[model samples]
Target chain A: MAFPPFAVTVDLVVFTIRDDQLCVLTIERGEAPFAGGQALPGGFVLPDEDLADAAARELAEETGVGKDAELERVHLEQLGTYGDPTRDPRMRTVSVAYLAFAAQLSEPIAGTDAAAAQWMPVASALTTSLAFDHGQILADGLERARAKLEYTTLAATFCRDEFTIADLRHVYELVWDVTIDPRNFHRKVLASEGFVEPTGEQTSQGRGRPAQLFTRGDATQLHPPIRR
Target chain B: MAFPPFAVTVDLVVFTIRDDQLCVLTIERGEAPFAGGQALPGGFVLPDEDLADAAARELAEETGVGKDAELERVHLEQLGTYGDPTRDPRMRTVSVAYLAFAAQLSEPIAGTDAAAAQWMPVASALTTSLAFDHGQILADGLERARAKLEYTTLAATFCRDEFTIADLRHVYELVWDVTIDPRNFHRKVLASEGFVEPTGEQTSQGRGRPAQLFTRGDATQLHPPIRR
Candidate 1:
């Protein structure tokens, strides 16, 4: 017995902190389906692979960054699925886009199929010619990431594992494009359970006050969330 | 130059209020790809149709609910797209699933393709067999719906244009599965800008004490959002 064949693909919205600004990983598709145009790093999901595995694989493959592989652990999750009939010219495909966030990648590789791979600021990514409905997908991913910071204390993911409150606050300001009230922001961060835990250690960037260092909070969920 | 071929599909996750609990519309698949199993209503997206239009079309075809054919507009939006090359059994297909919130459907007609269409409560829906990863999609949709209530007064879309605070509160209870303090909820509702406004009317409800009625407020967003 045979079923109507299905096509599954993985698109990666890999975001990294570049010059303190959150940017997304993008590639220039060297082939058709908007060939030679800018697009999210993605490709087919093989039969033996799990959906997430496919995304991880496509990400590494499209970026061509990890011939040797970089971080084995990158935060990746299903963003959403887009399957507009006219999205691709060849066959019917249901593309599941995954949103991945990394602290920062320096020597990231380029995909064999890509003309070039680079991290573009989200603002700039919006204006470029994207291969498919990728522009919309990127917008959704960015919105989700921004909203996530409100309650999840996920901004710390953008910083090194250990950072100061000032460093974390800067992430919020950069991502939200709004300067938070430093006093209020500091109070709120400390008050929220599982938001952050202060480390006794102090940073040597002592030109100003020796800022206190901290790590991610113990709690996974935030209550009465913080929003801009 | 021809665009690379793509196979497009539409997956529908229909949410309805059943027994004051959030429920999802599901179908018993008649054929393969998890044949004879319950699944979200979906099919291959047809060319010459937009992604949203395809989802709307699938909703109509599978559940006998169509925007044009019916008087009440179905609250529909792009939930996101899922394209993992192996999600479907046949070939490469990209699927865009729509998240639709229908308050109380007066007419729920099952189309010929599906064996049956039923509103399964979320509690038990998890245990029952769904065709594929539709369960994950359904869960994400519910989570999105729940999160949306925090910042945006979108719950009104689940009710008629004019509703009482009690009705709005009921929506919160149903979606969140948590009881909210009435007095506190009232105060919170009033505090958040553009959440609700007095309709200058009261609902008799065939009772002694009339309840104040309200309509959806302005499009202002919630700051320090209410978490579920």
Candidate 2:
């Protein structure tokens, strides 16, 4: 019966595999709450927009990603909600955090009054100071990404449309931050039915033998997870 | 700088195993916006409460689980946030759904103006009508519970403090809605270190044998998940 004294926002932990490193898109907030501090790209959800739509809009606004490009190339899902009563200094703000992944990204052009926008490696981002509870949100999102890779075909989302087994393996290594056995990794990935299918064409990466290319298959849940 | 136009609420999907079936707690709404419809036990979150605290509070209020007992025995986690703009007829509301599990539970007593509250078999509840986006939330919660059993020792949360391997298997069978081989189930559960530990006691069920009792262990995740 009383007016709800709370606010809803959407924050995105937009991740990408770039140059053999796992990076997330972050912006330097231009507002009073931790102004000039790095934070996940996000803003308040509009009254009429869906949660996912708000996240996608904020992602485009902060990263300058074209709407079409974002819709076609990015994968987003609800991560979790954070409402700690005092999470926001201005009001009781409950943020629905989203986990997103994209293959490749260019330098960001800051929008929506963000002082700066750029891609920061997950490792460094974890160490850098962030606004509000964005630090914990980033940590949770990274763990989700790592755990998802073990049992889901999401790793392929971080690679080019046409990539080799090595390319897929690198995504795991970068995200998990571990050196997996190449032979074992190759064998398991190929054996996992509907995980990846060969393109029948091989591309030489250097002087060595040309590695066969493959694309993501239809499988969503891996039966035998690729353990870390 | 504008006031956030969204209202925040919490919905709980509390699951329990009873009579060889997985049941979820549901309450009949006592007010408009689908009044008298069966729904997951939930209400508007109070302003000063944390999200999880709000879920815990609502769980206790609607189900009559004592605060201390609920805090100790229940395992709760953020399932996901549902914000479809039109989910609530009153205004723009974003409900943070929570997934919870309890060992053995008694009949629920409706509280806080709920018309009635009771535990209903998940299968039957799925077919029955529910208020708001609760049906979708229930589906997601059920899938999460089923998947969690594969890798986490969460099934133990559905058993008594000290239970037999057969009792544990029944929890799996009931939640997954699939019968598992007794021998294979026992072997896999024990072999998975940190899944359960002997309690140095035994209990007799019906006219069968006296089975050894075991308690949940420290291990959170199984290396090789028990496949369904």
Candidate 3:
């Protein structure tokens, strides 16, 4: 029987804020299909599992990060797939790309089958030595994250459940890397009906100004659209 | 050297508007992977080609209706890749799902896979006895198209260059199957900077009220987001 000539790989373009800049988690490959090259952290998907579950499993497996983390939990979503026939050297391989967003991290532990794993600044990651179409995947993921922040309360997903308006603003500022007018930002968030609700609490985060703490609003959409 | 156990296939979730309902192009598989069964129009991706290009090419090769019928003018985009090990009975196959949006069509054609190619309403396509994760892919494509209509002039991508405002409005109404207030739609569309521009023209649609002609706008962002 002629063996089927296809393969499946999972590539993760995990983004996080590091040193006030958007960064991507990537690794130097250790074997063929792209050995000794920088690429997104991923591997062959196993049998008997859903795609999203596999992605989460891979993320934790590689990082050795527990199910829970200190930072506002990272969010993961399916990005577009890439399957240029020649994307891999061994054979025709299709890759499902997933986008992940984590809070600002001190450092990411690059996991197994990788020479090393580290957070590379997105600007630098934009043009890279990524093995396959991962550079494109990384760009796609970052664009998705930026666009998502505009219409959904997703930016808050990158921050803790309890946050000051200032904390919420930082998610936008870091993800978009643009300064948002605080007065305008505050008015916009509060006005978004279910965007953020006052928790009847406050945080002394600024050392002087007692900022009011709020939780994510019940509504899923951001009306009047938060300018990304 | 041991060969990499990977396979690549391209599955098309071809969509069209028929009888004012969303539909997809499908084929009856007569070969092994899913022998004698109904499935999306797809096959093994060949070596030395881009996946998206391959998908579009396959649609044309199978239907003999490329770049002509609005319902066949493949506007293909990657949906997502499925790479679970047990997805294929023979070996590990990574299917890169592609989404295609064609305008309304008159008739269907044969698929390249030596089976009947036909158009079925999106609702019925759901009860598919297809192979792999095609069901999930179809759902994702529909959701993406629905969400995309809110922002980009991507809906225009489903139609020809010069179409009437009523035609455009109908696209939204038909795709979402929701009645959009024509006047409000026109107003909201006109308000969005790059949504629709005055074509300084009209269409003699051979009926009452010759619709006003307009083209896609320049701004990419939908200013004053369109509400669903």
Candidate 4:
């Protein structure tokens, strides 16, 4: 018995914070099936490449961040796989989607497959119809990111290496689209084991008292997750 | 440029509680590559079938549970996808794995692809060398199940329709392989709103006081999650 063959591809949903808004990287399709339409950067996987390696390779190519050091900071994981019979018009394709979280990243350089690549606010991007089933994939990624912030130290990924409690709180506010009590947020962050470690340095604004700076802690999961 | 064609298959890690121990469904392979070795029940995805539909179909076939009502009670979800180049020696095959949580289920009947099917204790199953990369897949599935119980109302899926607080707590203890204080466990479960709903019924076990009976709640996630 012969099973039908499939073409496996990898699509990336790389997210970052820009100008206090959650943003995702997107590319304009350079060739048909969806030419000129905005879509997540991806392509067919090489025959022998691992699924995760294929995702990372796509991320590097689309972002133009060729250095392993820069890519290492980006938290990447398999979001889900999309394989509707008609998701791809041309062939039977199964797409393994990856979700990535990174601090502010440099402008993306379009790969050979994409006409143009740029960062777009998630809100505005959602309003536009993306090429393929990318709109659904982006929404799923956003939901995962929002939920991850409540239980993981992932919010720190959107901040600088050394940041104040307020800076981290702001990331939560922007991603969750709600205002959080600063004092409560501060208490929770400190209480959660290995969530953050103080740098023993302080940063002062123009008027308020200097705030202690901290770096992301070694622990990835929050024991008592910070509830939304 | 011609890309290599690959075969996509679905593998299930169906878990349940039996004889006070957590068990998983396994089948003895009847084909080459790992003939006679124990493996998860699954098969190739058809050309036009959805990925999830393929998984459900495989589950139905292996268990011989033809009724949809019976299948609906089982909580199934995508675990992850494994596509290591040589994971399958016969060819390059990408396996989309799924994890399922179920209460006590009827004995399984071997499908055409499997020589025999039975429920094996997860502890014992992990000790043996499973076929292909199934051992790794099973480990990942178990980790997902353990972590899910902490934040989601997934533990309820391992219980009967009506159960006492102790019944629910036992599910946690058995799955986590830990002894939890009954009083503390009760308090946490009640505090986590929407974790369970009182059925206004009581069950008298042996000489102990009649414990209140409860059913799975409408909420799928705990707000202040029950921490481990």
Candidate 5:
């Protein structure tokens, strides 16, 4: 029996927020087809692993989300597939792109086929040419993150487990790149049931009086979504 | 140099509303692996076509949405990828699933390898055994449709170009399997800016009175989403 002439690859658009800016994990390709250019950290799927497993494995190898991985702290989801026949010059390849978000990450460790890895600010990365169709994948990942914040508790993934309302608002401000009315943001978040629950503790981190700490609630979809 | 060991396929979960229920297009497989069983209308990606192009072609072939295709009227989007190495019995295959919605689609015409094609209510299709991992794909598609209704102008796709408030509410009720308060639904939908625009026409379709006509608006994402 003749096998279908095709190849499957997994790409990760890992996102993080550092220095009040949204950043994406990128690697310098050590091989041809845009060699030395920055690209999302990813690789071909193994015959024995699931697509998501391949994505996580590639993420671990490219970044350092290794064995001690606080997997739950990371929000990982399938972004979409990019399968333009001419996307890869060598062969007909279909790539399954994944979206991952977590708290600020340290520098990444390059894989065998990567020259180096680092977290690039989303703004700077969008202007640079990325390998293959990775630029499109990064754009889609960023949009997904922005949209998800409206209806899902995904924003919490970018913060520590215990955070104040201001800490959460900063996540929104940084990702959306807008300064929101702190009082309005706090009111909306508190009114949206299952969005967050007060921890009965306060944090004296930023200016003004200490703010109450809170954790993500049980709700996945917010009833009245916080509009962007 | 070695090629990646995998085949790429596209599976479409085409949905529509008919007889007050959400329906899915399904085909009976005429080939082995799961012969005589029902499956989503799809096939392996052709070497020369883009992933989405291949999906649209397969859709046209299996359901006769051919050339003069009302492609613009249909809302088609990539759902996600399913690649459990063992999901396919023949070889390691990665399948990209797509979700398509249109005004009530006619009975499907079977393609070369399908024995028959029919529009099955999503409720019934969920309980029936489908070939491969198609059952899971259908479920995901249904959920995507349900969720998209909350934050997008997608509900308009289910109605005719000019429709009444009752017609729009029915689409939501059918997909969500809930009875929404007609008064509240009308107020909420109208309150959301750019959700639907009045067309200066009325139709007495079902009963009672001739309702005002409206068409889909310019907005894609609803600012203050009409939450379910």
Candidate 6:
């Protein structure tokens, strides 16, 4: 039986922490269907390209980041797929959405199909009307990131290679939009096995004593999850 | 830029517990590509239909179940999407996979494209070489179901509307293939707030004294998760 033809695309939600706030990478559409409107940095999936590779390529093209170097520190995974019949106006399209977490990233450069590319604070971005179903997609990505932080060690991806527990707590605080007690967070981080490994190094936040440094551990999941 | 045309399809991995063993629904293909081989129940998405609607339609058609009645008791969610350039020999097909859980489903009847439809033990199904990357899809669905059971109250979907705590425990033991201590399991389930609600009813199992009956609770996620 003949089936309806579809045009598959990949959309990205690349998130990073900057200025103590969570920001997402977005592009200003240069083409029709939402010209001059904000949208996630992504494009059509090449016929032979793998879904993940397509996401990486789009990330590199839109942000001017080298796939090899930048992706080394980025934690990328499939968020979900969006295929509402009326989601896209051009034609029958199915978009596979991916979520990525990275530490402080460099400035972005606009791609061919984008008028501009830049980081937008998630709070303000939610208020602005985004192109297509991107507003819903971005909201879903944020929720996934927040929930994963409760049981996974992914928050470490938002910090430098060597960071103090305070730096890590700031990541959770900013992303979750909550103030977590430093003392309680420290105790819980230490109790969860393989959550962090001490680097035996020390660093000081201005006006504070030197604090021990640590790096992400091998365990990807925390047994006794830190509740949100 | 012109992109290669693609066909999008939906595949299902419906799972249930029967006779103390976890089983999955599968069908034998009636057409070429993998004629007479075992496969999941699914079909191509209609031009104007929603992705989820396509999945539910396929499930109902292949299983001979009414969409309204059967879907009321089934827990269905998107598992993931698969799109290897060479996954399908005839065309470039991208399949969105779905996973479902039901309680004591009725016997399945064959659909138009299927020569036969029935339940197969998950253990044996894994050993059989299923048509088109289905083996990998099945494994992924199984893993998702097992992990969700750890944190979600979805395991109750495999039990009757009113069941004893032992029935719930059995669902876990059979799916995880692990032997959990009965007393410890009982205490943990009750301690997890809103995991289950008492029905003020009792039922007898064999020669054992009457056991209190309960139904699924309002909570979806379990705190201090029932660790695997």
Model 2, residue pairs in steric clash = none
**Cα lDDT, model 2, residue A42:** 85
- Please, what is the whole-model Cα lDDT of each candidate in the order they appear? 0.76, 0.87, 0.75, 0.89, 0.86, 0.89
Residue B185, candidate 2: alpha-carbon lDDT: 85
**DockQ ranking of the models:** 4, 2, 6, 5, 3, 1
Q: A1-228, model 5: which lDDT tens digit per residue? A: 465667788899988888778889889888898987899888888878999999888877876675585677788899999999899998888889999988876554657677888888999999999999999999999888898997788888898889888888999998888899999998999998988899999988767899999998998887777878
Which of the two candidates, 1 or 6, achieves a greater lDDT against the reference? 6
CAPRI band of model 5? medium
Q: Write the per-residue lDDT of candidate 1 for residues A143-189, one digit (tens) a residue.
A: 98887887686777777778888988888887889899988888888
CAPRI quality of model 1: acceptable
> Which portions of model 5 show Cα errors greater than 4 Å?
A1-3, A106-110, A190-208, A212-219, B106-110, B187-207, B212-215
TM-score per model over all chains: 0.83, 0.96, 0.85, 0.93, 0.92, 0.94
Residue range B1-228, candidate 2, lDDT tens digits:
676667788899999987778999898888898988899988788878898988888988877675565567678999999999899888888899999999776665657877888889999999998999999999999999999998898999898788999999999899998889999888898899999999899887688788889999999888678878
| Candidate 3 docking quality: incorrect, acceptable, medium or high | medium
DockQ each candidate and list the results: 0.32, 0.78, 0.52, 0.79, 0.73, 0.76
The fraction of reference interface contacts (C-alpha pairs within 8 A across chains A and B) present in each candidate is 0.30, 0.80, 0.65, 0.80, 0.82, 0.70
RMSD of 1: 3.8
B1-228 in candidate 1: lDDT tens per residue? 323344566788888776788888888888887878889988765545656777778877766666464425466877766656567776555667788887666655566688887888987787776776787778778887887787776777677667887888888899899999888888888787788888999999876678888887875467546667
lDDT of 3 by residue, B48-89 (tens): 677877787787866665756543344667777776667777
Q: Candidate 5, residue B50: CA error in Å? A: 0.8
Clashing pairs in 3: A6-B6, A6-B7, A6-B8, A7-B6, A7-B7
- The candidate, 2 or 5, that scores higher on TM-score is 2
lDDT of 3 by residue, A108-222 (tens): 4858667888888888888776787787888788889898899888887766678888888888997898999999998888888888888899887656789988887777677
- Can you write out model 4's per-residue Cα lDDT over B53-147, one digit (the tens) per residue? 89989988887553668776788899999999999988899999999898887754657668889899999999989999999999999999998
lDDT (10s digit) by residue, model 2, range A1-228:
675667888899999987678999888887788987889988888879999998888888876665575566567888999999899999889998999988886654567767778888999999998899999999999999999998899898888778899999999999999998989999999999988988998998798888999988989889788888
lDDT of 5: 0.86
